[model samples]
Target chain A: LNVNINRKRKWDIGKLIYMENVSAEDCIKRWRNEDVDDEEGGDSDSDDSNEEDFFKKKDENSSKESNPKQTIDLEQFVPYFDTFEKLAAKWSSVDLIKNRFIRSAVERK
Target chain B: MSNSKSPLRIFEGHQNFRLRIVLATLSGIPIKLEKIRSNDLNPGLKDYEVSFLRLIETVTNGSTIEISYTGTTLIYRPGIIYGGSYTHQCPNSKPVGYFIEPMLYLAPFSKKKFSLLFKGITASHKDAGIDVLKWGMLPVLEKFGVRECALHTLKRGSPPLGGGEVHLVVDSLIAQPITMHELETPIISSIRGVAYSTRVSPSLVNRMIDGAQKVLKDVGCTVNITADVWRGENSGKSPGWGITLLAEMKKNWCLFSECIGDAGDVPEDIGAKAAYHLLEEISRSTAIGRGQLPLAIVFMVIGKEDIGRLRINKNQIDENFIHLLRDIKKIFGTEVYLKPVNDPESDDFIATVKGVGFTNANKKIA
Candidate 1:
């Protein structure tokens, strides 16, 4: 049964949507459990601990963190765009954020 | 049959032009790309892309490239792979790695011994820096039966004011097709790195190394990293320090990740982020991580076997990768298959392909 579901999931290619508002620190913390937000508390509006708990709960529910909003880590843009004006213009700005949007209302496997 | 013989088609505005061009050249298939950013202002190919095409021409003989006056359309006809000593002044706007990555793919297959002296930014956050390639790509080449390949960073160049230089020498050998049926579980034997500082205080390198090593140790990885501090002429026009970490597995496979210390970016964060990437790769059961998948796929597409397989992440197979896979199948008739696994131990998927069994153009008829 799991294999059948796995086969179905493999065919499901989610369109990559680059989320902009999410900062690099937020991504690293969420991905690696860095817990930097607890220390800095830079964005006073959002409670860091509550957000972490939310992520952990969601992650447990689904093995893969299937967040609709994906952040193309700023680091990937390098080497390729360092000096190329076109690549820099294409990927450098917030275009990644503009590129993809979540279409499916229901997260179908 | 006529349609199949036609040049492979590519639309405009795609970023992997270099990869596509190299693939076309290696496969000896003509390719035509049109509507290159047609709707955009200052559309067509960029200065760096043109420079990249010129470099591709230098490595090959009689390669034909045609571009529209507005630069919106272009056609490329590949030529023989004739590699020899070359000295190229890389466009100041891009790091040398942009040129180096493609050069690494084509060098071993050249008829003559490939020796190159590249002058430009040696290390940048944008491309795989010289440090990353030396540890990551060089070993991969060696694994594929490429011998006597040497990658050296002669000088360190930073961005904007890049004057870095690198000398690479690869033997003239026909690339023997390889079959890497299964990627062994990555047992990180050691974590090695270079904390390089150019036109900056040597202490910066130490601080970066300390920050990076702290994270590696915390993650239970061997902190076997080293530091390289350059002064005066060796350091380029700009002042910066960054770290490049190479996680060497028990097998020859290497996973490299790096970050640069930019304005407002703390050196410690740069070091820690690079370490985190290495930890992420080590944590994965896949043979290649996201960083090296594209490069590995390039080899798989060109191998002499009828079939090749490797374990990889499904998320790693992005749009550019999909484009490349399709192009390879069209140009070389290689069929690629992706199989997903539900194993609780590893989330990685299996990518298998039947190669076209392409041999070098220069191979003597026997």
Candidate 2:
């Protein structure tokens, strides 16, 4: 009788070759920094003016280093990143319970 | 005992309570939980949590659990998992899924074959339903070399007057460490589902299947959904209907989506919603579903000593996920690395971890 092996295969406990490449400390540090970034981003809306000023200074610094034409191009790219950051901030604060994708995935059993 | 040297891991709040217990049990590290819903008008452990603890005690050997008078503080020193045939009546406050979720973590590491008969609400809004476990979770376990497992839904029960029954049988991992290398999301081979209704109109099940098929037809895959209508005795005390959809992908991966009918919910709408949810999951193209990430992480951490890799969507990370990582580090001392997938357009991240190679000490060697 032909049977699907994938449906039948079960193995017992045995040691496999250990391969460790990533450092646990660095991973923890990265996760911590990401958390800090999330907290800051969530509160960024309160300091809107400061953020705008910072962006303006960044644009000015870029303009000083490059030609006038490239500066205009850089200026055009700045708002895209700004909007992306704002979107990220908004995304983080939105309750996952109310999110359509998450609710759909969770509501049923 | 190794438990003597390990300091009790301290935790606060009631978040991820079941997971904390599972980790403590698997790692053999004692834990102290305080301030569990302490500030609430009704403080302390919920009825469902107590029921879960009772079930844990029934399944394990020599476990010690201490709860404060007000139930605000809890100290748990886990015992050896001595899995055997048992029956547990779950609380009505939460569904049987709540209990079964944690049991999945502990059962495979048990000394004997685990056979548990759970009687309670099988489907609810609060937890993944029994169908999800049978179709979705069991397949994931299969990827980790756990094949001798099955979840049979003996009865259909909905909330308020839950009388459902489900039987779970899992054999302990005796020879090989759990290993899975599913990083790339495979194309879906087919779609299968079950639309079940209890103490309700049989027509509702058909409507739900129609709604799901209407949405899934455009995906160019075989969609087969069965309508399961239960009557007296088999149907629980309350009237309810729901749909569970499973997208079976190539390479033995399955993604599940479910929608339970609430008050004034249309069967068609529930079906469409579940189908849309499934489409969203397919689009994300992660190895594991967002809701299954925590369970997958736990399995990865406790797997073989070798490295395991899983692809998960970075956007799925939330407060609970972050806290789980922190708690794992505290209890198991295992940290997992997250590297962005090569595709710039996708939000997927590859999580890499070296397992602790946890084997069942209670299982006798032949």
Candidate 2 error regions (>4 Å)? A1-109, B364-366
Candidate 1 residue lDDT tens string, B1-366 = 012365556644444577778778888778888877676678898787888888888888878899989998888888888888889888887788878888878887777888888998876756778887787787777766676788878889888788788988987486555765764445555568888888877887888887777665533335566889888897777877788888666667777778788877777767766766555444442556665666677777788765777877644555345545655655666656765455664456677776666677666535
TM-score of chain B of each: 0.93, 0.96
lDDT of 1 at B83: 81
List the pairs of residues colliding in candidate 2: A12-B175, A12-B176, A13-B174, A13-B175, A13-B176, A14-B175, A14-B176, A109-B128, A109-B129
Where is model 2 chain A poorest over a 10-residue stretch in terms of lDDT? Answer: A11-20
Model 2 has an lDDT value of 0.71
Clashing pairs in 1: A78-B126, A78-B127, A79-B126, A79-B127, A80-B126, A83-B93, A83-B94
User: What TM-score goes with each of the models?
Assistant: 0.77, 0.77
Candidate 2 per-residue lDDT, tens place, B1-366, comes to: 127578899987786788889999988889999998788899999898899999989888888999999999999998888889999999898888888878888888888889999998988765889999888888777777778889998898999788999999997465434776768866666789999999989999999999888766555456789999999998888889999998887777787888889879878878877776776655544657755677788888888799999887654443345556777878888887766578655556678889987776765445
State the number of backbone clashes in model 1.
7
Cα RMSD for candidates in order: 13.5, 14.2
